[model samples]
Target: MVDTMKAAVFQGEGRLEFEERPIPQIERADHVIVEVGAVGICGTDLHALKVPPGTLSRIPTGVIMGHEIAGRVAEVGEDVLSVKPGDHVLVDQNAPCGMCEMCRRGRPNYCISIRNVPGFPGAPNTYGLFQDGGLAKYVRVRELNVIRIDRSVPIWQAAVAEPIGVGLHGLRKVNVRVGETAVVLGAGPIGLVVTALLKRSGVGQLIVVEPLELRRQAALACGATAVINPKEADTVERVLAETNGTGADIVAEAVGWTLDTCIQVASNGARIILYGESELDDVIPIAPTLIGIKELEIYGVFLAPFVFESARSILESGTLPLDQIVSHRLPLEKVHEGLDALRDGRALKVVIHPNEF
Candidate 1:
């Protein structure tokens, strides 16, 4: 095997440099080396690349940045027995310290050690964000972070499992009921994935609110019964009309900046899941009394903690419109272009093939 590999290193805010680095070897008995096949450009990556950087600015400079990853196991440590070499696997980026209070309480997503906190002394344990991730030909991951998948699953498709798992986790939190009205406040990747999962859960009317016509069409393909263009009409009015003036039973604020609209269009006792991550410094004005008066339950979703296996099963079923979700597939060298496409609102899920380049 080659000794050096080309990796996309995060130099600083708005700087992602491709440089040759030594291929990682198993330094510990629990380490596993993977030959990365595909890495999906997530919204977090864009956040990390922002001019002043978003919440992910805590990522130390020089770390490779790609979390949504899938690849073949090239080598395994002596102590790793869960997966053998040549196994197809999905990388669970959020590796929480199992000994943390939150982790012991079964909420590893909020593990204090790796959780994103301003000025927190502890470094994040997440891959791509704080460690060398799969944005290169190879990456070294702990065995605990690797989940083996069927060999028949396409690497590009497997790379999207993280987002799908995120959607699953959010949906599970809300516990969508059959024949209910659901509204997704964006048709971005997470929005679309949630929309598809909502449909599978038997929602009667799945409404998607998106300004982009292309995504609206994509939402429909993902089983959205109705779509509203917020730019053309009042989103709240349209959503209420679709629900016969009662509003949505479940609302997903997947656009980050549309929490107000999600609140405005939610029916009494509606459950709203905040799946989008906006700028950390950004805020929206909302009347707290409105939530109390409506008895709405609001939930904030973060990283996928325990839903990777479910996501793997869903992907292996080949039911979701994977093509609709994955809008672009580019090589590693064109990572900048992929980021640009996502930033320009021209793509949904962009998968980068590091080895193919």
Candidate 2:
């Protein structure tokens, strides 16, 4: 094994340089060293780079950028027994200590102790943002972050596992059922994954709302029966009319940029899932009286917990065209190109290959 490995290091805001660093040795018994094969570009990563390096800027210069990756264990320490060297796997970016209140409750995504704070004792500061990333030849995996995958799942598609897991987790908790109609707002990767899961989960009908022509078209490809361009029509009125004027049975707001989009577009008793981040932008306006009169269930899906396995099942089932959502692939040296593409909305999901680069 080489003493040094290739890593795409983020030196500072707008400064990404691919360089060589010493291969991280297993610092703990439970740690595993993985030779990273692929990592996907996520929107939040781009948002971090754009907005004046606030919380994410704490990441410091020389941090690796990608968490979504599939690789094989090159080495596992003495305490690591769940997997072996040469085993194909995808690492969970979010983690919780088994003894923490959140983990004890089976909601590991909200791991109280390690919740989003980088540089925890044995955690990777890079995987979920703080240190080095997987846009390199190797990534060090903390015991909790690693999951062995089916060797058959393509390394490229396995990158979908994490994001898809998030969608599945929300649906599992949303209390959805077959024969119900849902309106998935937002046609990004996660949005499309949610729609695909809803269809495979047997929803009666799905109407996807997106202003982007490309994303709206992709939504249909992901099994949305109808697509609505929010910019082209009155979304609320049209949705109500499409659902026999009663509105849909469920409304999953995948576009969370503003609160306005989360308005009730369902019948008297309906479930509205706030699955998108844009909802963070504006206050959701709706009559408090309506929520009371209609008996509504509104849920906020933060991330996945205890649902990676189900997500893998959905991906393995080939329920959606995972291949199409990913629009570009560039070498690690072209990290800026990938980030730029994401920033401009020119690509949806782009994979980075440090090895190939």
Candidate 3:
């Protein structure tokens, strides 16, 4: 085994430096070392790289930046028993402190100490953002954060489990039912995933709103019955027209600042889930009275709490058109290009192979 490995380190805003980092070793009895095969460049990574940074500005400089990770276990601590060396695995980026009040109440997703809280101890928080992650040849993970996958599954597909889990969490929160009209604002990666899941859940009419023609087509492939180009038409009117003037039963804001559109297109007693959050400082104007008058239920989705296993199962089922979703696959060195592609709306999901080069 080599002593040093190449890693992509965050260098403040708008910079990612390639550097040689020491190969991590198991410091704890439950620590596991993984030989990284693939990691997905997420929207959060792009947000962190923005000038002045976006919502993910809290990500410390020098941290390796990739959370959607999948690899084979290279080593396991003495106390680790669930997985062994050579096991294919996916890493759950969100490692909430299990002892927190929110976690004890069965809501680890709302754990106050999920992130590195000041003066708090043992807050694993999240991988890639708060700590060194898998945008490198190797990553050290706690056994609790590692979930073993079938060896036959491709590493690239496994790497997307995190985002898929996010979609699942949002879908669960909205309590989607069969034969309902659903409108997804934005056909980005998360929206596409949610569209696919909503289709699989038997939604009768799935409408997607996106300005980009490429993503609109991708949304159709993901089972969207109709797609609206917000740039070309009034999104709210189109959604209501698609639903025969009743509007949609469920609305998902996946474009991060389309909450207004989601609210405008939702039917009475509809459920809305906000899945995109790229900017922490962004605030949209909305009519609060409409929420109560319409009897609408609005939910803000955070990290995937308990849907990792289901996400993996969905990926393994081979039901989704994974090729349509993963638009680009680049080596670790070209992560900048991947980020650029996502930023420019030229790519959907970009997977990075850290060990390929």
**Please, what is the whole-model Cα lDDT of each candidate in the order they appear?**
0.90, 0.75, 0.88
Show pairs that collide, candidate 1: none
Number of the top-ranking candidate, with TM-score as the measure: 1
Q: Rank the candidates by lDDT, best first.
A: 1, 3, 2
Model 1 per-residue lDDT tens digits across residues 178-211: 9999999989999999999999999999999999
Clash totals, every prediction: 0, 9, 0
lDDT of predicted model 3: 0.88
Comparing candidate 1 with candidate 2, which one achieves the higher TM-score? Answer: 1
Candidate 2 overall lDDT versus native: 0.75
Which scores better on TM-score, 2 or 3? 3
Residue 327 accuracy (lDDT) in model 3: 97
Please give the lDDT score at residue 267 for candidate 1.
95
Per-residue lDDT tens digits of candidate 3, residues 241-313? 8899999999989988888778788999999999987555567898888888899999988889999999889
Those runs of model 3 whose alpha carbons end farther than 4 Å from true positions after fitting are 116-124
Q: Mind giving the per-residue lDDT tens digits that candidate 2 earns over 230-290?
A: 8889888888878888777778877665334445676778888777664122465656777
